[model samples]
Target chain A: MAFLELDQLSAFYGKAQALHNVSLSVASGEIIAIVGANGAGKSTLLDSIMGLTRVTGQIRLEEKSLIGLSAAGIVRSGVGYAPERFNLFPYMTVRDNLLVGAYTARNNVSDNIAVVHKLFPRLQERANQETSTQSGGERQMVSLGRALMTSPRLLLVDEPTIGLAPKVCNEIAVALKRMRDELGATIVITEQNANFAMTLAERLYVLESGVVKAEGTVDELRNDERLTAAYFGH
Target chain B: MLQIIVQGLLLSGLYALIAMGFTLIFSVGRVLNLAYGAYLLIGGYIYFTVSQTLGVPKVLGLLLAAMVGCLVGLLKYRLLVKPLKGNHVAVEISTLILAVVVQAGVVFIYGDSSKILLPIVPGVTQVAGASVTYNLLAATIGSWAILFALYWFVRKTHVGRAMQAVSMDTKGAAISGVDPDRINMFTWGLSGMLGATAGVFFASYTQLSPSMWVAPLIIAVAVVIVGGIGSIIGTLIVAHIIGFMEVLAVAVIAPELRGVFTMLLIIGVLVIRPQGLFGREEL
Candidate 1:
């Protein structure tokens, strides 16, 4: 069985349904990417998986049903999610933000802090600074570092490269790849940046208007002229 | 002159105790529990009924008061704050109504006449050639101890940091495996307990009446507004500023004009800074 599975998941925001009968699965340690245009339910999928939004369907992580769990429960069950916007607490210092990430694991907070600081040296340098004053790249580092503090097995990152420069985007993409390769974390990244997604993702799903339009290996999608035509309006 | 300084310090301690409870609820729940002052009244009356009237032990009276406060907080969160769900204006309105209701209930139980509480520890001592009651001294010392412990708890303890996380961002806190609901419940309980404790001290310092809750509520509101949200040091400093201001006004100016300065200070601070002196940032 897949390490994580979603079967026919449907979700809504108040009256309007955002996702319709979406199903997907990821094997352990797989790097899966969801590529879509804006408003394509990319965020909704991650939100549903994190239990931030209500959904009606079967979601199982390692065969443990996640339908009735709260967001905190989902996190404790080994799912780490970083939302589209870098949601670091602006008023809190970097170290405090990192400390908050380990709220569920009080015993190993120091060890986790050491691990995260090693992963991102910039975070270590600016550990005492308030998050509001950090540069965009640094803020993203703090967000990722905070997520990593949970020591997650499956990491769901939504639009990590949003509103960042190419250099910063490259930095984030490299960090994500390193996280997967080194930490053995199964990563599901949602992106509108096709070039970035194509480079790092082994498997890619194209979502459009709340439905998956295409799914394939990166090389397979790269070879399809029609797929490029559809996405870029070529 | 010495009387003003000594009284100011004693009043500041009590003010800090009162403001701490309000701060806890505001920080964790991210809303003003307009009914927070009612906890103090409930605590005071409960102590009065159990200890003074029924001849129960004073310590047990305090504990009973704290227990009542805890129940009131839990019920308020479950019945009022939870149902309202992030509607700040709604929670504020409902809690305000709840406070008035609690006050009325107190009137129904205890007659409308204000009752002077016998000092918990009766004695007097000369400080700087001024006679000071041991009751005020005990209240001040107790307030300082509680404040120090609270500050340390928030800074060092794991659960306290979780409360801070929820205060900063509810969704983010949840994502980090900190249950916001549990934190909110814990905060309300703590707030209620502190309020009740402060109420007991406040009643002994002044006198107990059904309407006693209103003045302290206003004082807490002032401290929160002037300090801003989620600032512990700011709350403490603002509490002292208000407390000392009241003491100074009573000493130099007319005693009737003490609260007037506090109101002016709030208005002036609101007009100028708005976010408060030490407020971190707008939430």
Candidate 2:
């Protein structure tokens, strides 16, 4: 069995369906990316995994199912989400934000904090600064570092590079790679920037209108003519 | 002059204490707890019953009152708040009705007659040519101690930071593994404890009556409105402003005009800058 598996997952917002019959799987400690256009249900997929939205699916994390668990319970079971909107507690200090993130972890929270700080040295410098006062790039580091504080076996991130400069985007890319390499946690990321997604992820799934339109290794997807037309609108 | 200053300081401290619980629930749950005053009423009565009737030690009575307030707060959250799912209008109406029913319950148990609470600390002391009751002085001291502790708790502790997180962004807090539900419940309980403890002091300052909840509730609403919704230090500052205004009004102007200026201040602030003197996010 795969380390993390989603079998026939569907999601709804009130009467409207957001995601339909989505299936994906990830091996232990591998990096996966979901690329899609606007309103293609990338956020809904991550929310479903985090149990923020109502979902009808089998989300098997190793041997256990994450179907009925609350968001906090999902975190306890070792799944973390970094949303597209960089939802840091704006009033709280940087260190406090990370400290709040590790509330579910019983012990060695300071150690986890130290690890995230090492990954994001900018966060360490602005440890006492309010998150809202920070720049977009620093806030992004704070949001992602906060998720890392939970020490999840699997991490899901959505659009961390939106509205950021390319240089800052590259910095985030390097940090994420270092996270996978150093932390040894499986990661699933969603992005609207197909170029950025292709560069970061080992295997890529092209999502279109809440369904997996095409999925393959980076080389296979890069060579596809349909992907260029569908994704880049060429 | 000294009388106004001394009295204003004491009364402002009590106002801050009473407003603490109300501000907390409003900040965290974003609901107006109309039954908040009932926590004070219950607190005062509980202390009366324990210390006076049962003849328990005063310290134990205060502790018991705080405990009862906490219990009532938790029950309110579980039964009233969580069930309604924080529909603001519904929670407000339900809590208002709950307050009246609780007041009636207080009347039924303790009788409609207002009771004089024996001062927690008896004897009067002369300060700055003004005769100050030890009870009011003790209340002020206790209020300061509690407020300082609460400030430290919110700024320093783990659960407190989680509360700050939830207040700022419930969804964000949850994604970070902080359960908003649990934090809301705890906040409600803490609010109750603070309200009830303040009630014990306030009851002694005035007298124990079921109707006593109204004035303090008005004060709390005023603090929340003018001081901004979520800032504790804002609450303290506005509490003093109202307290001094009332004291000065009574001393300098007609006694009946004590509440008039407070009303005017509330209207003026609401009209001009409803977000409060302090910014909204600085709690």
Candidate 3:
């Protein structure tokens, strides 16, 4: 069985269906990417998994169904989520933000904080500064660091590179790869930037208007002219 | 002049204590608990019944009052605040109604006549040729200590920081694994304890009656509005401003007109800087 599985999942927001019969699975320590255009239900899928949005169907993490759990319960069960909009507590300092990640796991918080600070040195330097005052890249790092503080087995990141400069995006991409390599954490990233998503993910799922249209390795999808025509209108 | 300064400082401490709880709930829950004044009324009555009537130790009375406040807070969060689901207007209206209900309850139990409370520490000390009651002094000192402890707790502790995170951003706090519900509960309980404790002191400073809740509620509201919402330091500063203004008015103008200047101050601050003297742009 896969480490994480979403079987025939469907979701909606106030009568507007956002995900329909979406089935996906991730093995242990695998890096998976979901590429799609805007309004393609990438965020909604992540929200459903995190229990921020309502969903119908099976979501099993190691055979334990997460269909009815609250967001707090889901986090306690070792799933961490970082949203596309970067939801850092703007008034809190970077260190405090990281500490909040360990809100549930309070015993080994200092150790987890140390690990996050080692991964991102800039966070340590600006630990005392309010997150609202941080740059986009730094704020993103703070968001990732906060997620890492939870010591989650499964990390769900939505659009890590949106609104970022190319250099910063590349840097974050490198950090994501390092996170997978160093922590052996499984990651599911939703991206609009297909090239960047392709570089980081071992496998890709292309979503269009709430449905999975195609799934393959990066090179396989790149070679398909029909996929490009559908995605990029080329 | 000396009396006014001394009285202002003492009164401001009580005002700060009362407003602190209200501010805390607003910061974390982003909703006003209009029933917050109910805590003060309940606390004062509980203390009066336990200590003054039943002849319990004054310290024990204060503890009983605080415990009642905490219980009320937990109940409010579980029954009222949570179920309302962040409906600010509803919460405000309901809480205001709750305060009235509590006032009526107090009247039913204790009667409408005002009751004089024996001071927690009875005596008077003359400072600069001005006599000050030891009860007021104790209340002032207690208020300062509680505020200091609260500030330290929020700034230095783990749960406190989580509360801060919740106050700043509920969704962000949740993603960080901080349960907003838990934080809200804790904040409500703390606010209850603070308000109740302040009520005990406030009742002692003046006298206890069913309508006493209204005056403190107004004072708390004025402090929050003028200080701005969700600012601890701002709350402190504004508490002093209001306290000193009332003292000055009572000394220079008329005792009956003291609340008038406070009303004007609230209007002036609201008209000039709607965000409050120290409140953030959004709150």
Error of 3 at B101 (Å): 1.0
Mind listing the fnat for each candidate?
A: 0.73, 0.90, 0.69
- Compare the candidates by TM-score and give the number of the best one: 2
What residue runs in model 3 are displaced by over 4 Å at the alpha carbon? A225-230, B281-283
lDDT of 1 at B242: 96
Better candidate number, 2 or 3, judged by DockQ: 2
| Better by DockQ, candidate 2 or 1 | 2
Ranking by TM-score: 2, 3, 1
Query: lDDT of model 2 at residue A55?
Result: 84
**How big is the RMSD of model 1?**
2.0
Please tell me which model should have the higher lDDT, number 1 or number 2: 2
Please, what are the lDDT tens digits per residue for candidate 2 over residues A1-234? 798899999999998889999999899988889888888899999999999888887899996999998899999999888888878888888988888888888486988988887888888889999988899998889989989888898999999799899999999998898888998889999998888988999988888778887889989998776566556564
Least well predicted 10-residue stretch by lDDT in candidate 2 chain B: B274-283
Candidate 3: tens digits of C-alpha lDDT, residues A1-234:
899999999998989889999999999999999988888899999989988887888999999999888777888889988888888888777888888888877887888788777778888988899888989988989888888888888999999999899998988888788888998889999999888998899998888888888888888897776456547754
What candidate 2 gets wrong by more than 4 Å, as runs, is A229-234
Worst 10 residues of 3 chain B by lDDT: B274-283
**How high is the lDDT of residue B41 in model 2?**
96
Ranking by lDDT: 2, 1, 3
